[model samples]
Target: MTAVTAPEPAEQAKEGEGSLRSSAMRGGIYLVVRQGLNVFLKLIGVMLITRVLGPTEYGAYVAAFNVYLYSTLIGQAGVGVYLLRHPGEVPDLAVRTCYALLALLGIGLMLGLEASRGLLTGWTGVPGYGPVMAVMALALPFKLITIPPTIALERALNYKRVATIEIGGDTAYYFVAVPLALTGTGAMSLAVSLVLRELLFFVLAHYYVGHGPRFGFDGRTAKSVIRYAGTFSFANWVWQARMLVNPLIVGPVAGQHAVGIVGMTVGILEMLSIIKTIAWRLSVSVLGRVQSDFEKIRRAVTEGMELQIIAVGSLLLGFAWFGGIAVPLVFGARWAPVMQLYPYVALAYLAIAAFNIHSAVMSVIDRNTDLGLCYVVHILLLGLGTWLGVRHFGMIGYGFGEMLALLAYGLVHWALARRIGSPDYRLAGLWFVAAALGLFWRQLGWWTIPLPFLALATPASVRRIRRILEQIRKPRRAEARA
Candidate 1:
């Protein structure tokens, strides 16, 4: 019998690298497909729910929901990110410590929300806000507990399973909320639907993870996890404060109706920017695997910038072009403010899309302090601008505030460039300018309509498109040869 030879370490590493890239590509495609379905479901659901609830009721829901959302951040504590980006196999002790930390924080947040419900209601001044908040707060622990198992899957690049669990939970929410909203349940319909979604997620996440709660305390493990978690969470907290600005600042200054308008506009933009979400999640996994290679990370960011702007810019332009006619016709004139707010928010999201990979890279390389500083400048600019603008401009002020905050992205660029070299922003910049002009066409007029198309038809853009196609095909060609 001939003796079998084992593969060398270098060969083994090469195979492992190939497997990771293959898994990331497959996961990315699954997530894209999943988001496409989610977009459809959410579009239908938002149309129905917004029509039924209108601005006043929806505004109330938005306010309470924002409060609940901000509270959940406290419970998250960045444990999932730590787990996902851990260099190699995470220790069981670390996982258990994560579980214990999450549980304690989850319970603490739930109780805190319960205790502050009345105060929150009084502050927002939305009728029945306390009750709605009370209901939403119950989901905090369930939401937090689901993170560990969810991270377990993410670490393995099992996005197919993750997508299924998420879609199921989302479907449950719409099915539960739409009927209830049509029956005049008002804001409570959403609150109830949210609770159900979290419960379903908790169940499904654990089931697929194939494990029960395992809690333990290792002093060293706990210390390491908490050390990372603290920095990550603090940066996240500052970043998430942007969401709270709507409820805390706009709601108080311009009434809940304005809050509803801003909220709806933001929700729609988020739906359209679905690719950013998918890319960011995938980047944490993909980049972590290659974190030691600064050149690879830099290339990823450059390519990501070009591709993201192309993907999201078209959607934003389309919406900016047709949303005015569509919104009033489909959802009624009460939502007309959405069009006024759309361009500003769309511009912010566009800029974010181009630079989002920078943030992901920073996180992967453990540059939380730089990220935190960037976030601080962003939120400060946003908060101060919104407070001033809303006090002066009323409903449109939030949009103005978002525009002003776009300046802070310079900080992100600077911080990221300091670490991994600057990404090539030429293609992304061209697309951004083109999309910006198109988005503001209401002000710039019909002459600007052809500018975006012309930009894309340029020689550079055409070559870049061809290059991207080749990159996509190269993998398949390699697989075929193998």
Candidate 2:
């Protein structure tokens, strides 16, 4: 009998790395498809709900929803991130500990919101604000419980299952919310739909994982998780504070109608920047595995920046060119203010796309302190800029604040570049300048119409496009050979 030979460690490592890359690539594709579907689902739902609710009622919903979103940062506590980025297999004890912590935090946040419900209602001065918040708060525990199972799937790079759960939940939300809104349920339509979405997600997450995490606690595991989670949560909390600015500052300064207008502008921007969201989610899992390799991480950041700009820049510019007609036609004249706000907000999201990978890298490398400081600078600038601009310029002042906050990305870039040598931003920068100019075509006139095309015609841009085409084709060629 012939002797069988085992693979050497070097060969084994190479094979393992290849497997990981394949999984990550497939996972990324799944996420892109998922986000694409979500964007369609959410856009339709927003249009239907906004048309029914109008500015005043929708503004009230936005205010309460913003509070709920911000509060979730605390409830999450970043334990899921700790699980996702852990170097190797996480112990069952640690996973159970994370579950216990998340559940407790969720309950704590719920009770805290309930206790302060009256104050929040009085402060917002919007009808049905208190009840809406109460309903949204009830979803907190279910939302938190889904985290461990979701992280389990993410850790395994099984984004197809994750995508399925997310898409299903989102579909269920609009299915329920739109009918209720058409029936004149007002803001509460969204509140009820949100609860339903979380419940569905919670059940589906556990079911897909085969079993839910058994509740348990270990002192050492809890402490280690908290140590990492605390720093991570602090950075995230400060970052998420941006969500509160509209409700706390814009709502007070410009009133509910203006709040609705700004909220709608942001909501639309969020839909268009779905690529950024997918990239961030993919980075957290993919980069975490290669945290020890500075070169790999640096290359990933450079490629990610170029690809994101190419993907998102076109969408922003297209919206800028055509949104004026579409918004008024579809959502009614009440949403016309969204056009004026779109350019400024679009610019911010574009800048973020250019450097978002840096934030993900920082998290992978356990540089949460630096991340927290960057967030602090950003939130402070954003808060100050919005406050001064809103007070002075009225509704448009919020746009100015968004413009001013662009400087914060500079801080993030510097922090990350300091850690891992700077990424190649040439293509991203070119696309960014062209997209920025194109966004103000109303002000710049026909001259700006051809700029994005001009940017794409550059040799660097052409080379990048060819490389992307090759990458896409290579997969099909390999599949054919197989």
* Top lDDT hit: 1
Candidate 2 overall lDDT versus native: 0.85
What is the lDDT for 75 in model 2?
A: 84
Cα displacement (Å) at residue 167, model 2: 1.3
Candidate 1 segments exceeding 4 Å error:
1-12, 16-18
Model 2: per-residue Cα lDDT over 1-482, one tens digit each: 01112234464377576555566778888988898899989879988999889988999899989999888877888888888777556777777788899999999999998888888767766666788888999999899988888888887778899999999999999999999999999999999999999999999988888886578899998899889877888888888899999988888788888888989998988889888888888888777766889998988898888887878888988999999999988898888989988998898888888778888899889888898898898888888988999899888888888888888888888888898888887887888898889988887797987998999999988998998788767655655675
lDDT of 1 by residue, 1-482 (tens): 01112234465487786666666888999899889989989988988999999998999889888888888887888888888877566777778888888899999999998999878777876776788888998999999989988888887678899999999999999999999999999999999999999999999988887776677778897788778877888778888888888888898888888889999999999999989999999998888767889999988999999999889999999999899998987777889989988999899999889988998999988998889999999998999899999999997888888899999999999999998888888888888899888899998899888988999999999999999998887767767787
Q: Clash pairs of candidate 2? A: none
lDDT, candidates in the order shown: 0.87, 0.85
For candidate 1, what is the TM-score? 0.96
